[model samples]
Target: MTLLEVEGLRVKIRTEGGEVTIVDGVDYAVEPGQVFGVAGESGSGKTISVLALLRLLPRGATTSGRALYGGRDLLRLSGRALRRVRGRELAMVFQDPLTSLHPMMTIGRQLSEHVRIHEGLSRRAALARASELLAEVRIPDPKRALEAFPHQFSGGMRQRVAIAGALATRPKLLIADEPTTALDVTVQAGILRLLDRLRRESGLSVILITHDLGVMSSIADHVSVFYAGRIVESGPPPELLSAPRHPYTRALLDALPHPEAEGRGELQAIRGLPPSPRNRPPGCAFHPRCAYATEASLEQVPLLRPVGERRLLACHVDPFAPGP
Candidate 1:
């Protein structure tokens, strides 16, 4: 079932000079019990796009779009209505656990407050739910752990607590923004496994936002590749990794260091910095650095189009046949 559908989602900030568009005409949808991954490099608008949907953009930022969830437009919800929907029907795990968690509040207090406000549970019942949630996230001695503060747990454990709190109300959808970015590799793996397991057990749909393709591919059933303020391509991992149809998509895949090519050459990297929001290049934003750019590409923006079932691409130059 389609749980969320976002269309023509655009964001612009009132800058010193003028309004600078951050994300432009980005669209995607998430299904129930499916893991939909949004992947890109830093400043690719991956984070902002999701943030805009939740009406979490900074003050003075404007968002125009339709985010249909449960027969309502989430973008049009009032503050109180949105709050009612946010943690109860939908939840989010932010990028930094340290910053997202309240250092002053006890873990138990934080988690219980989340439940009491959303579920209308009594203090004792909410505390019991918090303990159960901590256990579900596999925190060692969950009951004892609840009494400790956020700082007492390691980075990975803190994230687990965040995840547990998000899941406390049994939300239908969870948005995880760079959940593993701050952890060590081993800890990152554990968190990934934990998310996958939770989805399996609860039938919870997820939208995981990250710049790491490897991380997304490991857990996401489908992936959307975002470029400067837009999605350049999207598909299943096998279709995209095997035969990407856009120049930018191909370049991103070629840049990965494969174990088969460990002794072949130095790791490839995409040259040129991402465009500044205020001064993006005209036409295709990537045309300046694209290997197959042409005069046509320099003058026209390619709209995202389907090349196959469940696959999309946006590039003037074809992967198999470069434009003249």
Candidate 2:
């Protein structure tokens, strides 16, 4: 079943000078037990898009879009309605646990608080449930861990606790925003595996947001590559990663380090920096950095065109067209 759907999502932030668009015309869907990956560089609006879904944008930011979850429009929900849906129906695992978790509150109290609010369970019952959740996330000796504070746990354990809290309500959709950014490779793999197992066992839908193509390739069923404020290309993992069509997507994949080519020479990185939101390119946002950019690409914007069964490319030149 389709657990969450977002279409024509546009987000704008108000600055001293004027309003600037950060996310433009983005679209995607997530079904039960599916993992959808949103990949892009730092300023590609990946995190902003997820924040917009929960109505968690800054004071000066405004969002317009249709975010349908369980037959309800999230964008239209207000006050109490949105609150009820946030931690119960759709939960989020933020990038950093230290900043996300309450430093002063004990881990046990933090976990129990959500259960009490969302489930309305008694303090005793909530504590029991909290311990169970901690165990579920593989935190050793849940009893002792609960008594400790955020600083007491290692980076990985703290992240696991954050994940545990997100799953406390057994939300239908989980949005993990760069959940593994601060962890090492081994810990990152463990966390990914744990999330994958939880999704399969509980049939929860997930949106994994990150800039690492390797991480997405391992977990996501469908991948969307974002540039500036728009989706440049989207398709199944094998197709998008192996045979990317858009110049920006190709450049991103080429930038990935290959062990085989390491000894030959230095790696080739994409030239130029990403365009600023305050001053985006006129036509294709990536034209300034794209190697295959032509006059046509610089003169007109390209819409996402159907390329394959489940593939779409937003580029002026059709890379798969008949040869010259």
Candidate 3:
């Protein structure tokens, strides 16, 4: 079943200069037990798009879209109704666990309260569940760990705790926004493995948002490459990373260090900065940094249409076309 379907998601926030569109007409769907990845550079609206779906955007931000989940439009849900869905049916783990977890509160208190509110469990029951959750996420001595504050744990362990909290309600859909950010490579791999295991075991759907295409290739079944605010290319990670049709996706892949290029030279870097939301280019936002850009790319906005099996691309020129 389609877990969540978002169509024409547009986010506009009032700035001193004027209202600027952050996410423009974004569309995607998440299937049950599938890992849908959203990848892009910083300030590309990947975070803001999901934030809008959860109604967690900053003040003065307005969203227009249809985020259908369980036959209801999440964007149009009442505050009370949305609250019930937020941490129960849908939960999220933020990039930084330290900021997400309370500094003063013990892990036990936080986890217990999270489940208590959503599941209506008694204090004793909630605490026990909290310990079980910690253990489920592979935290050693879960009971003792729960008594310690967020600061007491290492960066990786703290992230595990955050993931535990997000899973406390047994949400069907989990949104992890840069869950492995700031962690060591080993820790990052561990977190990704954990997520994959949980999804496989529980049939949980996930929306994994990050700028790291390498990470996306690791666990994401499907990846949507975001530029500025729109999805430029989307396909299965294996295919998308191997033969990207979009110039932006190709540039991103080029920026990553490859084993084949070991000791070859420095990695390729995408030129120029992402356009500011206030003054995005008329056609494609990535045209400024794209090496394969042409006059058509600068003058016309290409729609995201299917080009091959399970692949969608938004581009003017065919990267695989023969030279003139």
Best of the candidates, lDDT: 3
Q: What is the per-residue lDDT of model 2 for residues 1-324, given as tens digits with 9 covering 90 to 100?
A: 788889999999999989999998898888889999999999999999999999999999989989998889998899999999999989999998778899999999999898899889999999899999999999999988889999999989999999999999989889999999988889999999989999889998889998999999999989999999899999989888988888888788878888865576666799999998999998888989887788988988889877878888899976644355
In angstroms, the error of model 3 at 8 is 0.3
Q: Can you write out model 3's per-residue Cα lDDT over 240-321, one digit (the tens) per residue?
A: 9998889889889888988875697889888888899999998878888887888988998889999888999999886753
Best-to-worst order by lDDT is 3, 2, 1
Candidate 2: worst-modelled 10 consecutive residues by lDDT = 315-324
User: Over the stretch 26-117, how does candidate 1's per-residue lDDT look in tens digits?
Assistant: 88889988899998888989899988777889998999989999999988998789998888888899999988899999999989997999
Greater lDDT among 1 and 2 belongs to: 2
lDDT of each: 0.88, 0.90, 0.92
Q: Give me candidate 3's TM-score against the actual structure.
A: 0.97
TM-score of each: 0.96, 0.97, 0.97
Greater lDDT among 1 and 3 belongs to 3
Candidates in order: C-alpha RMSD to true structure: 1.9, 1.5, 1.5
Q: Relative to the unseen true structure, what is the C-alpha lDDT of residue 139 in candidate 3, on a scale of 0 to 100?
A: 99
Query: Model 3, stretches more than 4 Å misplaced?
Result: 321-324
